[model samples]
Target: MSKKHLIDRINTQFGENLNAGNTCFSSINKSKQVWWANIHLSKFADEVHLLLAGTGHFLWVTLPKDFVHNLSETFKIREDKNAVDLEISADKDSRYLIDVKSGGTGFDFRKYVREEVGY
Candidate 1:
Protein backbone atom coordinates (compact mmCIF):
# COMPACT_ATOMS: atom_id res chain seq x y z
CA MET A 1 0.00 0.00 0.00
CA SER A 2 1.02 3.57 -0.52
CA LYS A 3 1.64 6.07 2.27
CA LYS A 4 -1.73 7.64 1.72
CA HIS A 5 -3.39 4.27 1.93
CA LEU A 6 -1.77 3.60 5.25
CA ILE A 7 -2.93 6.91 6.61
CA ASP A 8 -6.38 6.26 5.23
CA ARG A 9 -6.54 2.97 7.06
CA ILE A 10 -5.77 4.70 10.32
CA ASN A 11 -8.32 7.37 9.66
CA THR A 12 -11.09 4.95 8.75
CA GLN A 13 -10.33 2.54 11.55
CA PHE A 14 -9.60 5.03 14.32
CA GLY A 15 -11.51 8.12 13.28
CA GLU A 16 -8.42 10.26 13.50
CA ASN A 17 -6.94 12.72 11.11
CA LEU A 18 -3.39 11.53 10.39
CA ASN A 19 -1.55 12.68 7.33
CA ALA A 20 1.94 13.45 6.09
CA GLY A 21 1.60 17.20 6.36
CA ASN A 22 0.61 17.03 10.03
CA THR A 23 2.33 14.01 11.58
CA CYS A 24 5.70 14.16 9.83
CA PHE A 25 8.68 14.56 12.15
CA SER A 26 11.71 14.63 9.90
CA SER A 27 13.30 16.56 7.09
CA ILE A 28 11.10 16.94 4.05
CA ASN A 29 14.06 16.96 1.69
CA LYS A 30 14.71 13.28 2.28
CA SER A 31 12.85 10.60 0.40
CA LYS A 32 11.95 8.91 3.69
CA GLN A 33 9.60 10.58 6.12
CA VAL A 34 8.84 9.76 9.73
CA TRP A 35 5.62 10.40 11.62
CA TRP A 36 4.21 9.64 15.06
CA ALA A 37 0.93 9.69 16.96
CA ASN A 38 -0.64 9.02 20.33
CA ILE A 39 -3.85 7.13 19.77
CA HIS A 40 -6.10 4.48 21.24
CA LEU A 41 -6.30 1.07 19.70
CA SER A 42 -9.82 -0.37 19.77
CA LYS A 43 -10.97 -0.63 23.38
CA PHE A 44 -7.52 -1.29 24.67
CA ALA A 45 -5.01 1.28 25.90
CA ASP A 46 -3.70 4.29 24.14
CA GLU A 47 -0.40 3.87 22.39
CA VAL A 48 2.17 5.61 20.30
CA HIS A 49 2.25 4.95 16.59
CA LEU A 50 5.30 5.68 14.49
CA LEU A 51 5.26 5.71 10.75
CA LEU A 52 8.08 5.87 8.23
CA ALA A 53 7.25 6.32 4.57
CA GLY A 54 9.46 6.57 1.53
CA THR A 55 9.64 6.17 -2.20
CA GLY A 56 9.11 2.42 -2.28
CA HIS A 57 8.33 1.52 1.32
CA PHE A 58 6.30 2.37 4.38
CA LEU A 59 6.90 1.24 7.94
CA TRP A 60 4.26 1.66 10.61
CA VAL A 61 4.16 0.50 14.22
CA THR A 62 2.25 0.83 17.48
CA LEU A 63 4.43 1.23 20.52
CA PRO A 64 3.63 0.50 24.16
CA LYS A 65 0.65 2.14 25.68
CA ASP A 66 1.12 5.71 26.75
CA PHE A 67 4.89 5.60 26.43
CA VAL A 68 5.71 8.29 23.94
CA HIS A 69 6.06 11.52 25.86
CA ASN A 70 7.88 13.61 23.35
CA LEU A 71 8.48 13.61 19.63
CA SER A 72 11.55 15.84 19.34
CA GLU A 73 13.94 13.73 21.40
CA THR A 74 15.02 10.14 21.72
CA PHE A 75 13.36 8.02 24.39
CA LYS A 76 12.99 4.47 25.63
CA ILE A 77 9.83 2.52 26.34
CA ARG A 78 9.37 0.70 29.64
CA GLU A 79 7.10 -2.20 30.37
CA ASP A 80 4.34 -1.50 32.85
CA LYS A 81 1.20 -3.18 34.13
CA ASN A 82 -0.95 -1.61 31.51
CA ALA A 83 1.14 -2.52 28.50
CA VAL A 84 4.39 -3.95 27.24
CA ASP A 85 7.52 -2.18 26.11
CA LEU A 86 8.01 -1.83 22.40
CA GLU A 87 11.08 -0.97 20.40
CA ILE A 88 11.37 -0.39 16.67
CA SER A 89 14.35 0.21 14.45
CA ALA A 90 15.50 -0.16 10.91
CA ASP A 91 18.66 -1.50 9.33
CA LYS A 92 20.63 0.05 6.51
CA ASP A 93 18.97 -2.36 4.10
CA SER A 94 15.51 -0.91 4.91
CA ARG A 95 14.48 -3.89 7.02
CA TYR A 96 12.37 -2.83 9.98
CA LEU A 97 12.43 -4.62 13.31
CA ILE A 98 9.77 -4.55 16.00
CA ASP A 99 10.23 -5.90 19.50
CA VAL A 100 7.51 -6.12 22.10
CA LYS A 101 7.92 -7.34 25.66
CA SER A 102 5.40 -7.83 28.42
CA GLY A 103 5.42 -9.67 31.75
CA GLY A 104 6.97 -12.80 30.30
CA THR A 105 5.94 -13.21 26.70
CA GLY A 106 7.55 -11.18 23.97
CA PHE A 107 7.63 -11.29 20.21
CA ASP A 108 9.09 -9.57 17.23
CA PHE A 109 8.25 -8.90 13.61
CA ARG A 110 10.26 -7.72 10.67
CA LYS A 111 9.26 -5.95 7.49
CA TYR A 112 10.96 -4.97 4.27
CA VAL A 113 8.87 -3.48 1.53
CA ARG A 114 9.34 -4.84 -1.95
CA GLU A 115 6.57 -2.91 -3.62
CA GLU A 116 3.67 -0.59 -2.86
CA VAL A 117 0.18 -1.04 -4.24
CA GLY A 118 -2.30 1.66 -5.27
CA TYR A 119 0.34 4.27 -5.76
Candidate 2:
Protein backbone atom coordinates (compact mmCIF):
# COMPACT_ATOMS: atom_id res chain seq x y z
CA MET A 1 0.00 0.00 0.00
CA SER A 2 1.05 3.64 -0.42
CA LYS A 3 2.26 5.77 2.50
CA LYS A 4 -0.95 7.75 2.79
CA HIS A 5 -3.06 4.61 2.52
CA LEU A 6 -1.15 2.88 5.30
CA ILE A 7 -1.33 5.88 7.60
CA ASP A 8 -5.07 6.18 7.05
CA ARG A 9 -5.52 2.56 8.06
CA ILE A 10 -3.70 3.17 11.28
CA ASN A 11 -5.63 6.34 12.00
CA THR A 12 -9.00 4.76 11.29
CA GLN A 13 -8.20 1.82 13.49
CA PHE A 14 -7.54 4.23 16.30
CA GLY A 15 -10.39 6.60 15.50
CA GLU A 16 -12.42 6.11 18.66
CA ASN A 17 -9.62 7.04 21.02
CA LEU A 18 -8.24 9.66 18.67
CA ASN A 19 -11.27 11.69 19.64
CA ALA A 20 -8.90 13.18 22.18
CA GLY A 21 -7.14 14.63 19.13
CA ASN A 22 -3.57 13.94 18.00
CA THR A 23 -1.85 13.72 14.66
CA CYS A 24 -0.69 10.28 13.47
CA PHE A 25 2.34 10.09 11.21
CA SER A 26 3.90 7.19 9.36
CA SER A 27 6.33 6.07 6.60
CA ILE A 28 6.66 2.91 4.56
CA ASN A 29 9.74 1.22 3.16
CA LYS A 30 10.03 0.80 -0.60
CA SER A 31 8.74 -2.76 -0.33
CA LYS A 32 5.59 -1.26 1.19
CA GLN A 33 5.57 -3.70 4.09
CA VAL A 34 7.96 -2.41 6.71
CA TRP A 35 6.90 0.84 8.31
CA TRP A 36 7.39 3.19 11.25
CA ALA A 37 4.73 5.33 12.88
CA ASN A 38 4.03 7.65 15.78
CA ILE A 39 1.22 9.66 17.33
CA HIS A 40 2.16 13.26 17.98
CA LEU A 41 0.90 13.66 21.51
CA SER A 42 -1.46 16.56 22.06
CA LYS A 43 -4.35 16.45 24.52
CA PHE A 44 -3.14 12.99 25.36
CA ALA A 45 -3.73 13.32 29.06
CA ASP A 46 -3.65 9.57 29.54
CA GLU A 47 -1.33 7.02 27.96
CA VAL A 48 -0.38 6.43 24.31
CA HIS A 49 -2.27 3.66 22.61
CA LEU A 50 -1.23 2.64 19.09
CA LEU A 51 -3.05 0.35 16.73
CA LEU A 52 -0.75 -1.11 14.07
CA ALA A 53 -3.19 -2.77 11.70
CA GLY A 54 -2.41 -5.41 9.05
CA THR A 55 0.71 -6.54 10.85
CA GLY A 56 -0.89 -9.98 11.34
CA HIS A 57 0.72 -9.70 14.75
CA PHE A 58 1.51 -7.19 17.46
CA LEU A 59 -1.47 -5.24 16.23
CA TRP A 60 -1.58 -2.97 19.27
CA VAL A 61 0.87 -1.24 21.54
CA THR A 62 0.40 1.01 24.54
CA LEU A 63 2.70 3.10 26.66
CA PRO A 64 2.70 5.88 29.18
CA LYS A 65 3.36 9.34 27.84
CA ASP A 66 6.24 9.57 30.26
CA PHE A 67 7.98 6.70 28.48
CA VAL A 68 8.23 8.78 25.33
CA HIS A 69 8.42 12.22 26.85
CA ASN A 70 11.94 12.88 25.65
CA LEU A 71 11.14 12.17 22.02
CA SER A 72 7.50 13.17 21.91
CA GLU A 73 7.99 16.18 19.68
CA THR A 74 9.72 14.19 16.92
CA PHE A 75 6.60 12.36 15.73
CA LYS A 76 4.19 13.56 13.03
CA ILE A 77 2.54 12.17 9.85
CA ARG A 78 1.03 13.78 6.77
CA GLU A 79 -0.38 12.33 3.53
CA ASP A 80 0.69 15.41 1.59
CA LYS A 81 4.25 15.17 2.93
CA ASN A 82 6.80 13.22 0.97
CA ALA A 83 8.03 9.89 2.25
CA VAL A 84 10.46 11.00 4.98
CA ASP A 85 14.02 9.84 4.51
CA LEU A 86 15.56 8.30 7.62
CA GLU A 87 18.91 7.14 8.95
CA ILE A 88 19.37 5.14 12.14
CA SER A 89 22.40 4.10 14.17
CA ALA A 90 22.94 2.67 17.59
CA ASP A 91 25.79 3.66 19.91
CA LYS A 92 27.51 1.55 22.54
CA ASP A 93 24.92 2.79 25.01
CA SER A 94 22.10 1.69 22.70
CA ARG A 95 21.18 5.28 22.06
CA TYR A 96 19.75 5.21 18.55
CA LEU A 97 19.71 8.10 16.14
CA ILE A 98 16.61 8.90 14.06
CA ASP A 99 17.92 11.37 11.52
CA VAL A 100 15.04 12.65 9.43
CA LYS A 101 15.37 14.07 5.94
CA SER A 102 15.17 17.84 5.77
CA GLY A 103 14.71 17.71 9.56
CA GLY A 104 11.46 15.61 9.67
CA THR A 105 11.17 12.91 12.39
CA GLY A 106 9.23 9.90 13.99
CA PHE A 107 9.16 5.76 15.21
CA ASP A 108 8.04 2.21 16.02
CA PHE A 109 7.37 1.24 19.62
CA ARG A 110 7.06 -2.47 20.21
CA LYS A 111 8.57 -3.59 23.48
CA TYR A 112 6.22 -1.28 25.33
CA VAL A 113 3.09 -2.90 23.96
CA ARG A 114 0.47 -3.55 26.60
CA GLU A 115 -2.39 -5.96 25.91
CA GLU A 116 -4.26 -4.85 28.97
CA VAL A 117 -5.31 -1.60 27.32
CA GLY A 118 -7.82 -2.30 24.60
CA TYR A 119 -11.41 -1.54 23.67
Candidate 3:
Protein backbone atom coordinates (compact mmCIF):
# COMPACT_ATOMS: atom_id res chain seq x y z
CA MET A 1 0.00 0.00 0.00
CA SER A 2 1.10 3.57 -0.57
CA LYS A 3 2.63 5.34 2.41
CA LYS A 4 -0.11 7.97 2.35
CA HIS A 5 -2.80 5.30 2.48
CA LEU A 6 -0.95 3.49 5.23
CA ILE A 7 -0.60 6.66 7.29
CA ASP A 8 -4.26 7.44 6.85
CA ARG A 9 -5.19 3.90 7.80
CA ILE A 10 -3.00 4.11 10.87
CA ASN A 11 -4.43 7.44 11.95
CA THR A 12 -7.93 6.19 11.37
CA GLN A 13 -7.17 3.11 13.44
CA PHE A 14 -5.26 4.25 16.57
CA GLY A 15 -5.95 7.67 18.08
CA GLU A 16 -2.35 8.60 18.98
CA ASN A 17 -0.80 11.30 16.68
CA LEU A 18 2.11 9.74 14.82
CA ASN A 19 5.12 11.43 13.27
CA ALA A 20 8.47 10.66 11.67
CA GLY A 21 10.83 10.06 14.54
CA ASN A 22 14.62 10.21 14.40
CA THR A 23 14.91 6.55 15.31
CA CYS A 24 14.59 3.90 12.66
CA PHE A 25 13.95 0.19 13.18
CA SER A 26 15.64 -2.74 11.44
CA SER A 27 12.51 -3.64 9.54
CA ILE A 28 12.58 -0.20 7.92
CA ASN A 29 15.97 -1.04 6.41
CA LYS A 30 14.28 -3.67 4.29
CA SER A 31 11.72 -1.10 3.13
CA LYS A 32 13.76 2.09 3.62
CA GLN A 33 11.45 4.16 5.88
CA VAL A 34 10.61 4.94 9.51
CA TRP A 35 7.57 6.10 11.50
CA TRP A 36 6.14 6.17 15.03
CA ALA A 37 2.70 6.29 16.61
CA ASN A 38 1.96 7.30 20.21
CA ILE A 39 -1.51 6.83 21.67
CA HIS A 40 -3.14 7.54 25.05
CA LEU A 41 -5.87 5.30 26.43
CA SER A 42 -7.52 7.36 29.16
CA LYS A 43 -10.71 5.30 29.06
CA PHE A 44 -8.79 2.29 30.29
CA ALA A 45 -7.17 4.48 32.96
CA ASP A 46 -5.27 7.73 33.36
CA GLU A 47 -1.56 7.75 32.41
CA VAL A 48 -2.18 4.53 30.51
CA HIS A 49 -1.20 4.65 26.86
CA LEU A 50 -0.03 2.62 23.87
CA LEU A 51 2.97 3.42 21.67
CA LEU A 52 3.50 2.04 18.15
CA ALA A 53 6.75 1.97 16.19
CA GLY A 54 6.74 0.98 12.55
CA THR A 55 8.14 1.50 9.01
CA GLY A 56 5.72 3.59 7.04
CA HIS A 57 7.41 6.58 5.41
CA PHE A 58 4.43 8.52 6.78
CA LEU A 59 3.02 8.53 10.30
CA TRP A 60 -0.32 9.05 12.10
CA VAL A 61 -2.34 7.98 15.17
CA THR A 62 -5.94 7.45 16.27
CA LEU A 63 -8.07 5.94 19.05
CA PRO A 64 -7.50 2.26 19.81
CA LYS A 65 -11.19 1.38 19.64
CA ASP A 66 -11.67 3.43 16.48
CA PHE A 67 -9.16 1.41 14.51
CA VAL A 68 -9.17 -1.82 16.52
CA HIS A 69 -11.74 -3.62 14.43
CA ASN A 70 -9.91 -2.91 11.17
CA LEU A 71 -6.52 -3.50 12.78
CA SER A 72 -7.59 -6.91 14.08
CA GLU A 73 -8.76 -7.83 10.63
CA THR A 74 -5.75 -6.46 8.69
CA PHE A 75 -2.51 -7.01 10.57
CA LYS A 76 -0.77 -9.86 12.36
CA ILE A 77 2.22 -9.44 14.68
CA ARG A 78 5.11 -11.67 13.61
CA GLU A 79 7.17 -11.04 16.74
CA ASP A 80 6.08 -11.61 20.33
CA LYS A 81 8.65 -9.34 21.99
CA ASN A 82 7.31 -6.97 24.62
CA ALA A 83 6.73 -3.66 22.85
CA VAL A 84 6.70 -1.73 26.11
CA ASP A 85 8.73 -2.60 29.22
CA LEU A 86 8.19 -0.92 32.56
CA GLU A 87 10.16 -0.67 35.80
CA ILE A 88 8.59 0.38 39.08
CA SER A 89 10.20 1.62 42.30
CA ALA A 90 9.02 2.85 45.67
CA ASP A 91 10.49 5.79 47.61
CA LYS A 92 10.88 6.25 51.36
CA ASP A 93 8.05 8.77 51.35
CA SER A 94 5.53 6.14 50.22
CA ARG A 95 5.70 7.29 46.64
CA TYR A 96 6.05 5.05 43.63
CA LEU A 97 7.70 5.74 40.29
CA ILE A 98 7.78 3.91 37.01
CA ASP A 99 10.07 3.77 34.01
CA VAL A 100 9.14 2.36 30.63
CA LYS A 101 11.02 1.31 27.48
CA SER A 102 8.81 1.08 24.45
CA GLY A 103 9.93 -1.28 21.69
CA GLY A 104 8.36 -3.93 19.53
CA THR A 105 7.87 -5.19 15.99
CA GLY A 106 8.59 -2.16 13.84
CA PHE A 107 6.23 -3.09 11.12
CA ASP A 108 2.51 -2.52 10.86
CA PHE A 109 0.74 -0.43 13.52
CA ARG A 110 -2.44 -2.42 13.06
CA LYS A 111 -0.66 -5.67 13.91
CA TYR A 112 1.02 -4.09 16.90
CA VAL A 113 -2.30 -2.74 18.11
CA ARG A 114 -4.02 -6.09 17.79
CA GLU A 115 -1.26 -8.03 19.51
CA GLU A 116 -0.41 -5.52 22.22
CA VAL A 117 -3.87 -4.11 22.92
CA GLY A 118 -5.79 -7.28 21.95
CA TYR A 119 -8.11 -5.19 19.88
* Candidate with maximal lDDT: 2
Candidate 1 wrongly placed segments (more than 4 Å):
1-5, 13-45, 66-91, 94-119
Winner of 2 and 3 under lDDT = 2
lDDT of 2 at 94: 43
Report lDDT (CA) for all predictions.
0.39, 0.40, 0.29
Measured over all alpha carbons after superposition, the RMSD of each candidate to the real structure, in angstroms, is 9.5, 8.4, 15.9
User: Least accurate stretch of 10 residues (summed lDDT) in model 1?
Assistant: 34-43
Candidate 3, which segments miss by more than 4 Å at Cα? Answer: 1-31, 36-60, 82-119
> Model 2 over residues 24-102: C-alpha lDDT tens digits?
3233344434335433334245665444433233234555656655442544434354222332222213423333323
Q: Write the per-residue lDDT of candidate 1 for residues 37-108, one digit (tens) a residue.
A: 222223124434445554455554444444434422223233232222333333444423433222312233
Shift of residue 119 alpha carbon in model 3, Å? 32
In candidate 3, what are the lDDT values of residues 1-86, reduced to their tens digit?
A: 44344434545776544343311122122232222222212231222223333333222222334433432233232234312222
TM-scores vs. true structure, each candidate? 0.33, 0.38, 0.22
State the displacement of the C-alpha of residue 69, model 2, in Å, after optimal TM-score superposition.
4.4
Greater TM-score among 2 and 3 belongs to 2
